[model samples]
Target: MNDLALRGDNIVKRFGAVTALDGVSFTLGQGEILGILGDNGAGKSTLVKILTGFHQQTSGTLSVHGEETLLKSVDHARALGIECVYQDLALANSLSIYHNMFLNREIVRRGPARVFRLVDHKQMRERAAHLLEDIGVHVPSVDLPVERLSGGQRQAIAVARAVHSNAKILLLDEPLAAMGAREAALIIDLIMRLKEKGGLSIIMIMHNYAQTLDIADRIMLMQRGRVTYEQQSANTSVAELMDIVRREYRAMRATTAQ
Candidate 1:
C-alpha cells in the first residue's frame, strides 16, 4: 500500500479575473508535517480551502490514500478522514471543554433512552480528558468552559478534538500566530508528539520561518498563487527562504517603481 496521505497535482483556483492559485502541486507522506509559508495574499489560504473542500479547484487533481477523490464539502472531507483546524479555532466559547470536544458528534447512550438521543455527557467528558492527556495537553478541568482557557490551551483542545476524530490528514492554519513564546512552545511540543505517534499526516500553514523550520519535516513556499519553493526542512535554511522572499519583494518594488 502506498503511504501517501494526500496528494495535490497541478492545482489551480480562479475567481472571475483573479487567480488565487496557479498550478500548485505537492504530496504529503503519512506521519509527515509539511509547512506552507507565504506572504499575505499568496494563495496559501486558497489552497487550504480547496483541500478542505471549502472550495473546488478550477483545475488539478486530488488523491487521498493513493485513490483519486473529489472532496465535495467540509463534511465530506471529514468523512474522508481529513480535518482542518483553522486560525479561528472554531470553539463554542460558552461550552465546556468536553462539550466543545464532542460538538456536533455527541455520544448517545445505547438503550431505550437512545431514541431520545440523550447525550452521554459522562462518556464525552471522560473521553475528552483522556484525549487531552494523550496529546499531552494539561488542563485544569474538562468541565471548565473553553473561553476560560488561555489561547494556547484552547488551541490544544481544538487539536485534541481533531485527533479524537481519528483524522488521517490534518490541516492546520497558522497554529502559532499571535501566541506568546511559552504558548507557542506548548503547541510545538504537541506537534512533535503527534509526529512521533506516526500515522497522522499534517499540513501546517505558518508565517514564522523559525517555527516552521523547527516543526516541519518539509516546507513549501508560495507566492502570487504559485509554489515558489519546496524542499526538505533539514536541507534548507532560514536565510535561504528569506533570500527568496527578498528577491521577490525587490522584483515587485522594481516593477512598481516603473
Candidate 2:
C-alpha cells in the first residue's frame, strides 16, 4: 500500500438518473504507467475527471500516496503533487514558452505580496530553458511564442509544465489524439523517457489498445461503466484485446435484441 502512488476502490459516479462509473477499482504503483482503455460512453472521461479532482465520485474511495484523500478541487490535487494534461493542453498560444510554463504558478519577487507581486521573468526563463533541456524537449528559445511550436512540441510543453509543478501522479487525457505518426512518436518517446526516470506514476486514458499496450506497464479495459479486464501489458496482445471487445459488444447486442 505504501509503494502505491494512487488507488481507487469500488469507485462509482452518477449524474442523477445515469450511472457513469460502476464499481471501478485500480492501483497505480510508484513509477508505473497504467493505460486505461475504453470506447465512448464507457466512463473513461468521468474517471479521468474524478482522478484529476475536477469531479467527485458519488461513492467509493481514493488514496494518494497511500493516504485516503478527498480531492477538493483541481488546485487541491495539484497542491498534493497531482497534475493533469488534457487534449487541449490548456496553453496560451500568444504567450512565450516561459510564461506558459509558469502560468498561474509564476515566481514572484521576495519583497512584494498580493497585487503588488512582481513576476520574476528572468528566473522563469532560466528555469524553463533548463527544464525543457532536462526533459529532452527542444525549442529555439524560451522567449518564443507557443504558437510558433508544432503540435508535438505543444504537447511536450504541457507535459513539461506538469513535471515542473512536481507532479507525482500524472493524469494524461488522450495525449496523442489526432496526431500524425511522427507527432505521436514524439509524445511516445517522451513518455518512455519519463518512465525510465522512475519517480512519476501515470494513468493514460486512451482509445488505441496497441499504443497503450506499447507505452503502459499495465492495461485496464472499461465497458459500460465497469472495468471488464485488467492485465500486465507484457502478457497481453492487441489481438486479445480486440477479441475481447468484439465479444463484449456482441453480447450487448444480443441482450438488447432479446
Candidate 3:
C-alpha cells in the first residue's frame, strides 16, 4: 500500500458565483498528523468535504493510496480507508454502544441470503468492550446506549470505531471544539495513542494552535480559500504560527472593513 494516503492537487470548488476553495493542494503521509488552520470561511470545511468525497472538486485531482481516484461519496471515501470523525459525531443516541461502534458494518453470521442471517451481537459487544478498554475509555457498559454516555466517552467510542475500521487517513474537524479542558486532554491523548500505536495518519482541523502544535507533525494554514503557509512542527514555533494566523485574520478584516 502507498504510504501517501491522500494527495490533493490544485483543488478548486465553487458554490454558484462564490469560490469556496481555490487551488488548494496538499499531501498526507501515513501515520502523520497534519493540522489544517484557517479562520471561518477560509475553505477549511470545503477542502475537507472534497477530500472525504462529500463534494467533488471543480478542478484539479485527488488521490487515495497513491492512486488517482475520484471520491464520489462518503461511502467511496470509506472504501478507500479514509474515515472522517466530524466534530459533531453522528452516533445514534438510541443504539447500544456496540451498535453505535459497528453501525452499518455489523458482523453477521454467514447464510444463503438474509432469511436467517443473525447479527453477532455477543461478538460485537465483546469487541466493543475490548476496544473501549484498549483505548482506555471508561464507559459504564457496552449495553448502554450512547445517549447515556458522557461526552468524552461518546467521543472515545467514535474514535474507537475509527480504529476498528483500520482507517488509513483520518480527518478530524475541530475535535476539541466545545470540549472542556479535561475532555480535550483525553481526546488529544487518544489521538496521540492512535498515531503512536496504530500508525494512523490524521488531518486535524483545529483553531487551538497551541494544542495542534503539540500534536501535529506538520501544519498547513489556509487563507481566503488558499493555503498560505506550511511548516513542520519541529521547525515551527507556536508564536510563528500564531503570527501567521493573526496576519491572515487582520488581512481578512481589512478586506471586509472596506
- Highest-TM-score candidate: 1
What is the C-alpha local distance difference test score of candidate 3?
0.87
Give the alpha carbon lDDT tens digit for every residue of 1-258 in model 2.
899999999999999999999999999999999999988899988998898889999999999999999988998898889999997889999999999999999999676453578898888999999999998898999999999999989999999999889999999999999888799889999989888887899999887888999999999999999999999999999999999999999999999999
Model 2 Cα displacement at 54 (Å)? 1.1
lDDT per residue, candidate 1, 139-214, as tens digits? 9899999999999999999998888898989999999989999999999999999989888999999999989999
| Ranking 1 against 3 by lDDT, winner | 1
lDDT of each: 0.93, 0.92, 0.87
The count of backbone overlaps in candidate 1 is 0
Per residue, candidate 3 scores C-alpha lDDT tens digits across 1-258 of 478878889999999998999899999988789999888889998888888889999999988879998899998888888888887899999999999999988888666634576788888899989988887777889999899987877888888898789787888888888888898899999898888786678998988888988999999999889999998988988899888888877987899999
Give the number of colliding residue pairs in candidate 3: 0
Candidate 1 residue spans exceeding 4 A from truth: none
Q: Model 3, residue 146: what's the lDDT?
A: 92
Model 1 vs truth, CA RMSD: 1.0
